[model samples]
Target: MPATTIHFVRHGQVYNPEHVLYERLPGFHLSERGVRMAQATAQFVAENPATQSLAAIYSSPLDRTKETADIVCQAVNQARRVRQEKPLSVQFDQRLIEAGNNFRGKRIGRGDGALWRDGNWRLLTNLMKPSWGESYRSIASRMTDFTYEQVARYPGQQILVVSHESPIWTLRHLLETGRPEHNMFLRHAALASITSITFDSSTQKVLGITYADPAGGVQ
Candidate 1:
């Protein structure tokens, strides 16, 4: 049976100075180092045989994700141009967005306007089900929906998807462990990393999962 692979990429570091929880917030873009990280990953994708001939490219609607996806898409297209292949553009999808959080736009430190202040600590009850803005199950459900749709759309091919850490990891955890609930602090999805999942094109059964971090050493 033919195989299909979906490479899920986590967006690079943001330009947040105050260290606020910028979850799902607009106006947050990638940092200077983040651009280099994305460039490294783009180059990796462009040179890697498994991903160079990507059938499609997708990204979360957030600014950070869009920026990273644009960089990768440009690199992929440049490589495709050399082979005289049709170029692919980055398609935005809301399902690939960052996990919702009640702490958005708030710092996680002590004192005024902090996440722990003004009885906000009550939301820290459970990290598994996560008593926060969005449950892990919800994030995984949306991500799974998106992944299955793409798998069917581009059978026997490989595609790239740029998404946030939570959604990507949550879906992976759900598929691999049969549970989406996990400790948020221990997520394996790193910045500018690629988590690829392969499936049987005809049966849609998961074949395997792999990971790579091209920008792991980037400062």
Candidate 2:
């Protein structure tokens, strides 16, 4: 038995001039800068020796994630050869979708456009459990289950999962410290960032975790 690694990648920035929450919203594709960012991330992963052994790629079904996954799969196919003769294909996983939010299509801010102005006090009453959207525990549970499943299915290999910011960060926090409480303001998961998890192939136990911003400083 050999060790396995999984990389959780957050999608690039979207072309939202209004800065809408866009939670699970459709048709929100990547911006121009985002395209460059995704390409840079794919190239970074392709050139990195550690990720050369990636065997499979998985992504959320959202347009942004699908676009990023396509670019990454192409780069990995051209740069590295997996055990299979064909290039690694991108698979869709609903569990990797963005966290549900009631604030979708709304401009989120402390100004007048905020949710509070509309008298939606119920949504803001509980920040600990996050009354606005899906609970952190739910995201963590789903992501953890998906990760362990992939590890078990692909022992001795590496896999890449392209996902949204909330799910990626929540899963990272849970796997890293065994806590699911997440603070949106304290997020470290940059757009197009990669969070790596290492697992013991024999026991399917989590060994360690790491983080990287492949598109950093590439604005």
Candidate 3:
């Protein structure tokens, strides 16, 4: 059995001037530069011979992720000669969504930390388990399950998934170290970055992992 690869793509920058911790808040779409970044990432992936065999594209239901997935699928279809009636067909999965945060609408700037000021200081007790919102272990479990399901369904083909930084990073940490705990301050996935995981088709075990920021130098 041949190995399968899945590319987890983090969405581009949001149009949040206030620097709000958007979290899973609705209506937070991509910014103008973000659109360009998504297009550039699509072009980079499409033109690369390694990703030419991508069979399916999946995305989170959020606006930013959907937009990014659309751009990527369009470019991939054009490059690979796969025709679709719509702009690009993408399957949305809730498991690929951003990590749920208790401070969704709050700004991340100074001011005694919104959560603490809001009397949510109790929620900060466990940073390792991340008592503020969804735990890292939960995020890792959901994402890993989704990835394994896709790997089983599409054996040797490459698959692309548009997701958020938290989930992707958490999943990456879990896969890399076989542990769910990680330092949230350390950023693993960048905006519009690609984290590729290759799995053995027979055992569904991870064979290798790679990271790339196709739109890193764009700005």
Against the reference, the lDDT scores of all candidates come to: 0.93, 0.87, 0.87
lDDT of 3 by residue, 1-219 (tens): 699999999888889987878888888999998988898889988888777568789999999999999989889878766444333479999999999888777776667545446766667787788888998989999998999999899898899999998899898898888888788888678889999999998899999999999999776
**Ranking 2 against 3 by TM-score, winner:** 2
Query: For residues 1-219, what per-residue lDDT tens digits would candidate 1 score against the true structure?
Result: 888999999999899888889998899999999999999999999999988879999999999999999999999999999999999999999999998898887896866778888788898899998897799989988998999998899999999999999899999999899999999899999999999999998888899999999999999
Tens digit per residue, CA lDDT, model 2, 1-219: 599999989998889987777888998999998988899999989889888668899999999999999989999998755445567789999999999988887776677676566876667867657898899999999988898899889989999999988888888888777897877888898999898889998897788888999888767
lDDT of 2: 0.87
Quantify how close model 1 is to the true structure by its C-alpha RMSD in Å: 0.8
What residue runs in model 1 are displaced by over 4 Å at the alpha carbon?
none
Clash count for each candidate, listed in order shown: 0, 0, 0
Q: Cα RMSD to native, each candidate?
A: 0.8, 2.2, 2.4
lDDT measured at residue 159 in model 3 versus the true structure, 0 to 100: 90
Question: Looking at candidate 3, what is the lDDT of residue 8?
Answer: 92
After superposing candidate 2 on the true structure, give the runs of residues whose Cα lies further than 4 Å from its correct spot: 81-85, 109-114
Evaluated at residue 195, the lDDT of candidate 3 is 94
